[model samples]
Target: MKQSNRKVSGTLRVWSGVVAATLLAGCGGAEPVHPDEPFPQTQEQAQENVAAAPIVESMDAIALDRTLTSRTRSLIRARLAQGQAQVHQQVPVVSDSGQQLFLNDQGLNGDVTAGDGLFSAIGDVDFVTHQATQDRIREFQARNPQRPLMASTFDNRVRVSTRPLTALSPSVFQPGVPIPIFPAGITFAVKPANSLIITDASVINDPTRTYDPCSNSGNPNGVWTFNHLMREMANTYVSPSVLTEHWLRQWTVNQNINGWTVPARTAMMPYILTPWPRVGGALDLTRSPFKLVAIVNRLDLGGGRGPAGYASGNAGELRFVFAAVDRTSGTCGVRPFLVIFEYGVPHSSCDAVKTWAQRWLELSAPSMVLGSSAYNAALASLTQQVVVRNAAPRKPNGSAINQIRTNEEWLRYPWELREFHLMGSGPSVNRLQGQPTVLTPGDAHNDTPVLRDFINANTPAILANTYTVPTTFPTASTPFLGAFPWIASDTTSFWRATGISVNEARHKFSLNTCSGCHGRETKTGFTHIDEFGTLSPFLATGMSDPSIAYVVQDPVNTSLNREFFEIEMRASKLDSLANQSCLASAFHRRLTSAH
Candidate 1:
């Protein structure tokens, strides 16, 4: 299944242009704060304040709404609108071998072959080319070393004519001519069913051919099998179900952690410290924050799971635990942090995973082991700083504080389709059937501008107007949510290029988007649904459409209709809202005139 080249069909086209213009305009605005204003307090002061504040329990709408102001909310909404438009318009062309190419009409055209000098026209004027079978055979022979030779006989047999004299002399054959017969051996006598029969040497060496459980007892140091290693790894790590819950709980608690303890920090240290040695200079911390969170472990269970686990459990299990330690108070609590993990059986004929795990353990042992006290102290200090700084009120003179807050709030709710799914329903709804959209995280294709803007506009109070030292922690002005949609868009594009349907692609994108904001609790509720408004009846229904069970049950709907419907619906909804707002008066006028 192939998705349509047109990303922004019909209605989305207009809105996309509007969003792009708005984003460009927003970027040109002056910095929100004045240069003359007094510099904000030191980083230590901010940390102390964060450490002193009380930790919140839940991240419900009430809490989010309370935290965000009108301006911030507007910003988030605008950003969401813009992100949708961006994702819909950006159609990234990716190959099966993981090659990514930006696609447009020109690129699409280039992929098609037109009639040329070497190529001949086929049926209906289609261009086609023919090659000799002998050439193909030669290429095949070159690639395959063990090709068999076909038996053949010489047709011109002049030698047979010379042998006619010998044929003329043919006469009655001798009666006792010895024939070259293949060797024939006598069958061994059958032994009684219960009787034991054996040769001395064979018995000692072979033992029981029928039932010998310990055949390879002599090879003690033999390679470990993949299944054995996978089992060991599984036993080492928490189960996927449990791990998922653990990560969700940790993020839900919004626990702070010691920066040193962060897996990403350690994973990325080599790249940061030795940037020039790597292929792309040093690892860009800004682009690869996941490196800080990722931890390579020799132990079988340490690597985290990916999103594929939701269906067949190919996704590994990741247990992300966020804890904030207050050094001054000597107290530790859960904090908000993103954790992703994957789990699955290793692909190996034998001892593959075992060998890999063994090698990894040997190499990563130093970084894999974590001491409780050391981790606690690191987390405590990091938490104290983040809490205090984030809790402080923004200075009136500048917008840095605002920007920081925006970024933090954006992170808090990160754009995901799952969030929208949850927002559409409540506790009254039976969540067995999950949301319709599958959302991903990260801006591989750079589609997060609108979401960022929206978050920036909505969370005015949390915006940071001043810069603080140690800018790593979440701040009021950080555009956490801004980057989410972009990430999700990229992930979706990657999946779609692999022949996913637009509807299912949208559903997955939506799931990632909603999950970014709603967390893992919403995963179970992320069930598949049918067009008849019923829960998906099929068990294996990721890309499969419940509405159409026939026609080979294609999960990916590669056609343009579904995309068109979704875009039209989204645009209409936005247009209706714009009609009611004075800010979009000009837009409404243009729309009305076009109609």
Candidate 2:
């Protein structure tokens, strides 16, 4: 793909003077046109175009535990409501900013600052603090038997990135841009040799030189680590449920690494290599074993950036800031981090067991060692703060403080809304409650104001269905209010799978989801990376005369066109998919041994 063609991040950076006109020809003409594209066509042609998009096999493919979903939703809501009430009662006289109210609201404040004290010691990698963290991890596992620490039994289940590849020799790399250390198809090693940095071009080019994360020997200066077993399962190709390429795409984003500005599709390789907790199999797929995935981003705060691609709120104090110093070299960098929030679910969404499959999805603001004891403890502390503050009665002052209360349930996280996906929808879990009611085709396509209002108004009916596990999900006859299906699909073939129409899918996922930000019109479903031929030259390729200049002028329709072809072409493919039995057997063996 051309450099200019790469999807822009938070801001859209497109080529300067590429005028788009021919591509949008006949859009306003009276002739019947494809609902998605502006191309004028006869009624027969429009019908044929509609049939080209992929279709899901069935409207109701997944089965879910509605009772559990409903209960969980109620529990979460009650706690949130309590928090809201507490805020109002404590701060009767509210300020315009609401910051003071949030900070001073005393209901959820804990007496001990142990978390703060422990965080302060991160720069030193203090042995005492490390032991304390280990102890916490042990306690967390004991309390939640469902999330087992698998890495303890098998040492080869984790991988780490020792240092950024030097071979690319990136120059003209703007320092202002967040530099990505992991490059696509770059070779990595389990351990750093005498020279931690590898610069030889030949060695870098050799595919055999690649290292397995399971073989990591505890590199302290590593960028990140992964739960290799989870990586293996996700990397393995399966029908509809698991796409190895989709798994790869989750980690890859465009970043400038080693001075080279390039796309880093596999940089997040280390995330999959994160070590498993002492417990095992806490995360299970709603569809395939690899269905549940986690991502840990090293919040690039060097250039005054906030957590996960935004400026941090609260003057950066809300972020879990820590300094990682190299013990041997004494080189240090202040790093604040975020990881997918861990929660337990039953086995597969289709056949949920008595044992819940725990998943880490949303980004948690509170910091701790990944998969260590401190993580759950910190999470518990924050969750406690959230629940208690809202539920607590007014302070002695009698003024109500509605700190941390947001009409939207998803916004409650405050820090993770940009990247959170509540649940993976699949046929087996289709009936699982919490899925929102589907909107009619007319409402989905032309009713932008209604969709926006539905998201913002937080009415009783909308609130009941908004963030909670849905009591019912949309089907072919009835589709979701937003373009949610495009987020993650259980289709054997994505986009192409039979289900909703292209026009409805485009609006729900694009416009309704993120207000069409992140270059909304250029996206292929929820994916931000460039793949569909919606760009200038590509859009003109299929024209009656390829020599003519054509580009989808409207970003919205441009996005629709890209998504439409992504399904029709089945262009999403993967490299290789590693099997999971090895890790699964080892995990079970260790659990049995422990028992």
Global lDDT of each candidate: 0.20, 0.19
Model 2 lDDT tens row, 1-595: 2232132111112212211101110100001001112211222332232222111110000001122111111000001112233322221110111111111122122101221110000000112222232344455456656644221111111111122112212321221221111111111100111011111222211122111222222321111112322222222222222222243343355432212232232423333213221124332121111110112111111111111111111000111111111112233221112222211110111111101111111112134233334543333333222122112122111101111100111111111111221222232321111112122112133334433433343333222111211111233333233222222211111111122234333333332232232223333232221111112222222222211222322343334232122110100000000011100110110000000
Give per-residue CA lDDT, model 1, range 13-40, as digits (tens). 4334332222111110000000111223
> If scored against the real structure, what TM-score would every candidate get?
0.18, 0.20
Which candidate number maximizes TM-score? Answer: 2
Q: Which parts of model 2 are misplaced by more than 4 Å?
A: 1-231, 234-453, 459-515, 521-527, 531-595
Count clashing residue pairs per candidate.
111, 75
